[model samples]
Target: MRNRINEEITLRKLEVLLAYMETGNLAKAAEALDVSTVSVHRALHSLEEGMRCALFRHEGRNLLPTEAAHVLADVATDVIKAMADGIRATRQAAGYSADHMKIGSLYSLTIRTVPDVVIGIKVRRPELQAELVLGSNADLLFKLKQGAIDAALMAMPEPDPEIESIALFEDEIYFAAPADSPYARQASIDLRQCRDEPFVTLSEGFITYQGFMDAFRIADFTPNVVMKVGDIFSLMNLVSGGVGYALLPGRVRDVFAHKVTLVPLSSQYRLRQTIGLSFLRRRERDPNLLALAAVCRLAMRVPS
Candidate 1:
């Protein structure tokens, strides 16, 4: 029983077996493994002895594998591949020499901020591949905490000790309307006057939606929301089509310049969204995160 317990399979022995099976001769297997033919023969003999099975048969000067050897080789191949995959995954989780990065951001930033950051990162590390994960502020934050994303570019939330946040720029909230609407002509729109107007806004998890609620709350009323969408572009489309009024960040003005008009909110309802980069405090030393932070700082200086 003790001998049986001691005779366990090993990765090195399995590799030698696979090399022998693929090359079909001791001299060839030795050449493939860069070892002596005697070493390859010894490994196979030890493996066969360990298993207490006839894995090969002697046919003159050449050794031929039995059916059991073929079966063991197939299973060994899978085991080797799985171990390699696990090693790669473990290294990635540790943030060691990763060639791929996952970046999370709000849908609104795709127009400029995200593109600028990605371009800068590419210039710095041409070999790195970046995948963008766009979602609401809440969704992105959730993913960041879960390690599903490397970092997030979003409206800054309240300070948290566990997160490392770098502020990029400030964007003011504006009252958005169709170009032909009467409100479009106002220098600064008063939220109090628009109390009864129907509004179209992004869903609850979005930062803009929170700004909308905050601005309205200050004006002492709840908005008459006609519809709620998930993305800023769609909300802009609704506002442009005259579906309803909306409160949007000033950053969106450039992309929808022809379709909608953005008027500054009156002092009573004024709010600004501070866009920033957020990542786990523990991962602050990660090379990818360091590159992203440098790009964000450069962008901040250029006026966003």
Candidate 2:
């Protein structure tokens, strides 16, 4: 006979179950959560007893979570996120709330997209307060996972179950060079040409860094690197001063139009970046999140 789960399942038990599911080892999960291994073991056993089902099985020194554990883990993330949102809603209704939207973005976006998005949001929510954060792609994602930021404007990274995103547009990457360089006058530059040129790039943590590296890989060569900067404008400044060439997106082209020239990368490179607004998928239906997403969509005016 199928057994019934305990009627009074606590959130703490679910949290433990998830920790075990993720680590697949009691000791490591305990270390991750800063709890005792014995406590972690007890929690897992209590979860099994409460559900009256085997959620894990012994595998040597490891406690391997079973299919049932994985299934519950899927629901656990949503349940935990929903419960947190629920508390916020209740507190807001009781007039004990922090009424501000926190947003994160890349430094490259501060020039246009981020400012436009903020303007659109204020138009819809005149009394709304906003807290903005600017960082590398990885940094913003870490903040989003920790609930430090409600959303971000960036090149959509790989899909993660806990995240939801709305794509706004595709921007092409170009070879940026000094205005007087021969490459500046080329209709399109061949990757073979880049083989010998010294290149400047954003640091490894930035999304643009990967795209730059990928383009060079397609050419079957490594760029002769001369310097790495933290921001795009600085990278462009290095290009304009003839420090080194860089592959950069077109969105920021206008800013350096006077001193630098942008040439479309060849078809082989096929480099492009997709900009989007990303947030926790669990908050997809959240009123405030939905409202902000709507503002992003309307302001962007992109097709579905």
Candidate 3:
């Protein structure tokens, strides 16, 4: 009997019941629901018939809920709230007047790539605002998955199934030291030669850090990392101060051109990092976000 009763209940009937509960009169409930009084009365009758009991009893001009109706009303309230939340989420996902787009990126690209992308997007779509979040690759990926950020620019290809990535550019990694350092005068330095020197590098989870380690491993030596920092600026600062040298991307060299001297790596392994733009595949079809991505690709000169 309960299963049969539950099966007959519809969301529309529940909504009418809630409206009646709020107004205590059919005419007013219909007015609140933006329907004719007859429609409201019919919905109430259907709800009562489906439940196999009278949900409300008219006392004079007022209607009062029966015990079953009281219980169902509580449940209906929760269900209605859930439905409303679902609607809100759906609307948000559909980009219905959403004010800002949140973007995440590794610190290395934030100084150049991200700013240029933002500028280009604003130039094209002046009404759309961009919020930028800067962090490590792992941190940005985590934030993107959690929906704290809409998209991210980082080294790729990421193996996460939830994310879809587009290759932006391939940047070569070069060994850099202070201009007066012994290695600066050389056209290139062998990875094995730097094995004994103290190295300043990005912390783990960064592509550059992994590339540096891999380069050393390929050269049959392990680097002595004296310090691990979060951002390239700090790493370059350390290198400038001669605390230690580092393996950095060519983009970093472009940004910090005069601060340090970059020496090419004489490795056959082609120590290069591929930058990519990543976002959830589910969100890949969002028109606004797609447009923003298009502008970003244009700004970065990422090949389509």
Candidate 4:
């Protein structure tokens, strides 16, 4: 008779055990399940813990299933098969099979990067709709965590244990100023030079805003910030009208180049913002997320 164990064993754990039972090796089980060997090992360990029994015994170099393992594996076969239909129904109920993919990003990206990426995705998949949400780095990451959005494009998002991110590319941060300003005429301006300059900045909590503050910190001076706006374009418009100097991404040079100058900074003040794609790790297998990520990676390469 098989020893009774804890009922906390999950369907995913059972699926891992069934894969291992049929394959006879970790590599084979991982390959069949399309997961890393580490994931397989972890699931197997959890399964053993849940059942409160040693399921496999080390014999020579092989891990052979024990009597308990054999009994659980026999029952797991039917359970795993039944759960497949259950998963499909649940996914449908959760709108996982929706036609549109909701993508979240900062307000600044709307000018160039985000639009191009959406176009690129549609070019590849004509039927797939792209829904965009613009917000601060904090907002986008929160929606991603809550599953309100499938993915997010953010810069140096605050580290969270529940979310996983892949940095897509690096964009240099530039000090934005009027074309005729003394700072613009210089070959390179130090952040120290801007300490007395009235600055137009994005509202705090934005990654752009954070980078702006980092430069000030490195320069050991507080900036005379005169305005804190919500979006990059608004900040640029104010800078164009000569309200104040602002720090911006190099990507904005083309759009504002007519009235503004993208001056390079000294090494001390130069900061490259890392733009990353983040999604719930559990949904890494979703085809829509995979496709959008591929498009975004490609879009970052083509000049915006």
Most accurate candidate by TM-score: 1
Q: What is the C-alpha RMSD of each candidate to the true structure, in Å?
A: 6.0, 18.0, 7.0, 12.5
Give one digit per residue, the lDDT tens place, for model 3 in 122-195: 88778778898988888888888888888888887558788999888889989889878989889888887776
Whole-model lDDT per candidate: 0.90, 0.84, 0.83, 0.84
lDDT of 1 by residue, 1-304 (tens): 4444335477878899999999898889999989999989889988888778999999898889999899989998999999988988987987654889999999988888888999999999898899999999999999988889889999887788878999999899999999999999999998989988999999989999999999999999988999999999999999999999999998889878987999999998899999999998988988888988998888767545
Query: Residue 128 error for model 3, in Å?
Result: 1.8
Question: Estimated TM-score per prediction?
Answer: 0.72, 0.68, 0.69, 0.68
Model 2: worst 10 consecutive residues (lDDT sum): 91-100
Better of 2 and 3 by TM-score: 3
Report the poorest 10 consecutive residues by lDDT, candidate 3: 91-100
Choose the strongest candidate by lDDT: 1
Tens digit per residue, CA lDDT, model 4, 14-125 = 9889999999999999999999999998898888888888999888967799999999998999887778778767884564655678899887777788988898889878
Predict model 3's lDDT versus the native. 0.83
What does candidate 2 score on TM? Answer: 0.68
Rank the candidate models, highest TM-score first. Answer: 1, 3, 4, 2
RMSD of 4: 12.5
Regions of model 2 farther than 4 Å from truth? 1-98, 302-304
How many angstroms is residue 77 displaced in model 4 relative to the true structure, after the best TM-score fit? 31
Give one digit per residue, the lDDT tens place, for model 2 in 1-304.
9966585367987888888777777788899889999988888888888778898888787777788988888998999999999997985553232478888988888877777788888887777787889888988899888888888888897999999988888888899999999999999989887788899999987899989999999999999999998888899899999999999988888888989999998899978888899988877776667778888888677421
